[model samples]
Target chain A: MIEALFAAVLGGLLLLGLHRKVIARVQQRPGPPVWQEVLHTLKFSFKSTWVPETASPGLFVGIVLVAIGIWTAALAVVLAGGSILIIFGVYMLHKIVEHGFGLSSGSPYGKFGAVRSVISAASEIPLFVSVAAIAVFTGSLAISDIVAYQAVNGPLLIIAPPAAFAMYLVILSKMPFSPFAIVEGKELVSGYKTEHFGVWRAGLEVANAIKTSVLLGLFLLLFLGPLSPFAFVVAIVILLVSLSFVCAVTPMLAPFDSVTIQALVTVVMLGYLVLLGVIP
Target chain B: MSSLGGAPWYILEFGDELVYFTPYTTTLLILALVFTVLALVSRPERQVEALFGTDAIYAKDTTVDQMRFRRFMAIACGCASMGAVVTGDLFNFTLFVALVGITNVGIVAAVKNRHVQNAAFQYGLVALTATVPLFAGAGIVAATTGTLSIVALASGTVPQAPFFARALLCLGVVGEGMAPFYAAKAEMFRAPGAPYVIMCSLSSLLIFLRVAEVVMVI
Candidate 1:
């Protein structure tokens, strides 16, 4: 629990710092301070909300608590010790519930956002099924069991390249960059977040910071399983460097087109893993 | 207990164990790859007709789609409901229920409209009234069984409570479910479409609860 909490907090802050620096470098400007996100969150948390008369009076305070509660719960479930099936179910529940939030609101943007969420989630089904495949081969859903399986033979990445590639796509889609950002973008005033202000908005920012750290941690766990906790950090740095290189070399693809790209990549990777005898 | 997808092709067939077949594995991998490609290729196109549809209602906000707060409420409620599934004891489930209840209350309170307000008050009353009976019955069951556990109930090891707790729990679930639906029914509700959000969230929570019950049983 401590390890997950520590990772969530520290890793989140670091990623927040890195995200800004990278954007700044891209734009060739000094950019806001690395801690700008933290400051912004703090400011929002303290600001009072002017609840619109049209808005449910109860919502004046409820949304923030709900957002924070769900995000923290998701983070905890991922980090908790359990069977893979249970954890997977928990993750699915989180995604579905997020869609529900988009719909319950009376706003059109919220409804549209929910539609995008549905499509994004549908895309995740294949990725999750692949993860389930690994569990079938390994005979356990525990993360430790998965790590042990890779360590005993070789990393699953060597045998399940297709799975790895699919996971990479999930990482991008969930983080919501260029293409998938349609659901929650600035043009939509942060989509589902439009009516929210003060503490409620801050909940989202904190949830995002924590989520990034969790994603980075998962990346390290998948690619560098044999390493110790400290070593995982080193492995992540190397992976980030590689991701940055790829990011620079590749042109951005549209979200709709990503489906075909991912499919082809999966086919090739599966063949390679099978030929290499990485998957038994 | 395990069956392949609409076919008898076995992936890992054993007396007690069920696993995926190589063919099934390959299929999953291919599907993931396809989704990735589709995600990459389908950029939102800007057609004048698509943006400004012939209909007057959705003509505005055509430039970019948005998600609504109601949908998020449904999601949060679903999450809390799922959280209830992972707990090992009745107390924990109650706590989760309370958390979900508070979340629903919060969403209902935050949104505006007489319908929402009425729904929220009704939900609040039902929820509050039910919790008391739920606790009383649970307390009686504990007194009779000498142990209070969710698993015990699932296993049929604990003495049955005064039917009141089960009824209360069911009612609470209904009230919780309605909070999102009523909010979406309102006209002023903007952003993410309401009906879709309600459907997804309600269904997800229902499944989540069933899974959690199964876990308790086993």
Candidate 2:
């Protein structure tokens, strides 16, 4: 479990670096080194950290810890091959973390970010569709059981492409530079994270990296089936590259539009699930 | 009966009826307990100037009593949520849900802002009306199954409930601020305090979860 946590954090940072480089190349500019995020994390860790005078000191500090804790729990769940329902529950609980992050600071920017977080929370419902589809196909909600099913029946992506596509969009919404990034867009001066600085901000960044790794790892596990260590590394690289390309080409959507697009996708995914049931 | 450290593990009886506690209920109890402690330690954001006005703001300021009341309501919300999750009796679950709703209002009712007060009032109205279906559903279940005990329902000793009663139970839970009704409660979140305000959302969520479990088991 500790190794899984470490891998999620480190691998997530590396993936962020890779994303930066990929986006920079797309924009016809030289980006920072592939290890730039690693340096950024190290720098923030050593820097002095403090709670803003205007903020609720306890919640401000507690939220950062909660952010890290929830992501770590998500990673551990995935690594341990626990029930998917628990993973979904943890993912839903993240809305509280985001809400706490924004409201604890008492900044309008943070509050707006928090509101955006709430609005975008509707995006989580589509994930349920994916989980249901997988459960229908694999007959189990346990990650290990799903992996075992895939070993016999082949990758779920082959049987349920629409669900896989929905999961991909869910991952995109979480990644930087996507339309759903409106919560922390430039206009909000980093949104809910505006008040966090120094080591506290670093903690959030590390947590985000782990979250990225966990989501991608989950996507791979669900769609690509279980893989050898080398294959797993390759899968992560391929997934990150694809996500970077999408992030590079797309502009951030207005908050309302982002929610609309995700809601539309969710409706479509649900329709697909219904059709899957009707056809077979 | 099975026991955990000398305490009863499976059943808790009240008068002629009983409630069952399974591992799922235990898990949710632990979760509510953890969040309750988090609510206690976390500080409330004091941003009255931002919400109302910058001029002294003495009139609308939260009094010590109001703050204490909010704290009490938050603790009550947590306890009610734990009760809703752990109780094996359908009627007891409804009672806990109602307590959770009322305390959810209390958690934010102390805020002086018109908008916050209005939103809380609106939420209170919804919660008040929601009890109709909540209790009606439980009554319907008891009339049909001859008991309100979830253990009996789950053990297949009782007949399955009709769709109308199940839908009513779900309706009552959803009325407590899920989806369509959430808009009425969303503005209540603008209340200045983070810790107590969070309980408003957390309690509703926990009740919704417990309701789902109850509906499935019953």
Candidate 3:
């Protein structure tokens, strides 16, 4: 289990590197190597780090630990085929983590980033809606049950396309440069992360790497069912490339615009849920 | 009983009102514990604001007196959210949820800033208005199903709670949390006490997540 987790961290970092590369190439810029993010984490870890004078020392440091801890728990949940509702819960808590990261730092930019994170809470609502839509079809919230159901009844991607679409948007909203990631917008100078540097930033990088792996793996598991290890890797790459294309082509929306779009998506997903006759 | 979702793994009974731990509730319970501990140990940060037309940066300090009230409210909010996560009675869940809403207001009400108090007052109004639906929804569930115990409601022994009752319960939570419209909550977070202010968001989120399960189960 530990080895698998380490591999997930490594693989997830590579995927993030590839995500940057894909975006760069699409924009006609020569991109850094696919191992850039892995090296970036290593480099940040070796730098000197300390608590800022204006910061709440306990929370400034504690929030980083919490950030990594929750995502680690999330990765464990996905690995164990636990309840999908737990994943939805983790995804929502992540918004708080972002808020924590920004607010604990005491930087105006970080607070603004934190506020944007709060505003972006609407993005994850569709994830809950998607989970409910899936449970409506499978009659269970357990990941193992959903996978088993898909095995017998084909991929839910075909069976319930709207749920798949909703989950996809939820994942997209988390991607580094996607239009919905206003918390990490450039205008805020790395947004919530503006204040976290050195070892703290490295810890966040590790968490983001694991988050990337877990969300993508979850998407495949939910929509495509189980696959061989090699097939799973291939599917993730294809999905990452698709997301990168969308990221490269579209400029990030203004914060409110981004939230508005995500909320609209939630309304539409809720409409889809109503059509499916589920009141969730 | 060891199922990943809603199986009751541990139960503490108060006659018919029980505090139960399903794997789902356990996850939320742990989150509440984690944040509660953080609130206890963590000091509020001084917010740094750059001068409008100068290079000077000013840091706003949090007074010990200020921390006392917010910390107490934050811990109270945490306890309330934790109760909402584990309670087995539908009415208790609604009650716990409402308590969280009240504590959320208190978490920021200690701040002297007009902006923060303004936000808290508006949020308090929304939370107070939301209680009618929360209690009414729980009341309707008991009236129709003739039981307010979630264990009984989930056992298929009684009729399902009407769709409106469940929807109203969820609506009440949404209002208490103000999740879909977090603008008011956002303004409260600008008040400069991370640990305490977080309780406001965390409590509402916990109740929101718990209500999702409650509405589905009951």
Query: Quick one: best TM-score, which candidate?
Result: 3
Q: What lDDT is reached at residue B124 by model 1?
A: 67
Which pairs of residues collide in candidate 3?
none
TM-score leaderboard ranking: 3, 2, 1
Candidate 2 lDDT, A2-45, residue by residue in tens: 77778778889999999999999998999989989988999989
Q: What's model 2's lDDT at A136? A: 74
| Cα error, candidate 3, residue B23 (Å) | 1.5
lDDT by residue for model 2 over B1-218, one digit each (tens)?
Answer: 11111122577777655755554455456657767777787667765344355444321234678778898899899989888877878898899988988998999888888998998898888889889998999999999989888767866777987667877897887676453235556678777777777777777766765665566456
- The digit string of per-residue lDDT tens for model 1 on A1-280 reads 6676656765676666655555556657686777777787789989996653333233324434444544465466456523334334434444544543454344556555544544444344444435545644565545666777878878777766566666666565555333444557555556656656687667767766666666666655554466776787777665554444344334445434554454455556545545545343
Query: In model 3, what lDDT does residue A128 have?
Result: 79
lDDT of 3 by residue, B83-193 (tens): 999998999989888899999998888788999899889999999999999999999998999999988888879998999999889999998999778888889989998
Of 1 and 2, which scores higher on DockQ?
Answer: 2
lDDT of 3 at A224: 97
Pairs of colliding residues, candidate 2 = none
Q: Over the stretch B92-203, how does candidate 1's per-residue lDDT look in tens digits?
A: 5555566666555554454444765675576566566656654554455566566555444544665654444554444454444432223332322232223322333433
TM-score of 3: 0.98
List model 3 lDDT by residue over A1-280, tens digit each. 7887898899999999999999999999999999999999999999999989888888889889988888888888888888887888888898888988999989999999998888878887888788888888988888888899999999999999999998999999999999888998999999999999999999999999989999999999999997999998999999999999999999999888887888898899889888888763
Q: What is candidate 3's CA lDDT for residue A240?
A: 98
Docking tier of model 3: it is medium
Calculate candidate 2's fnat: 0.24
DockQ-based ranking, best first? 3, 2, 1
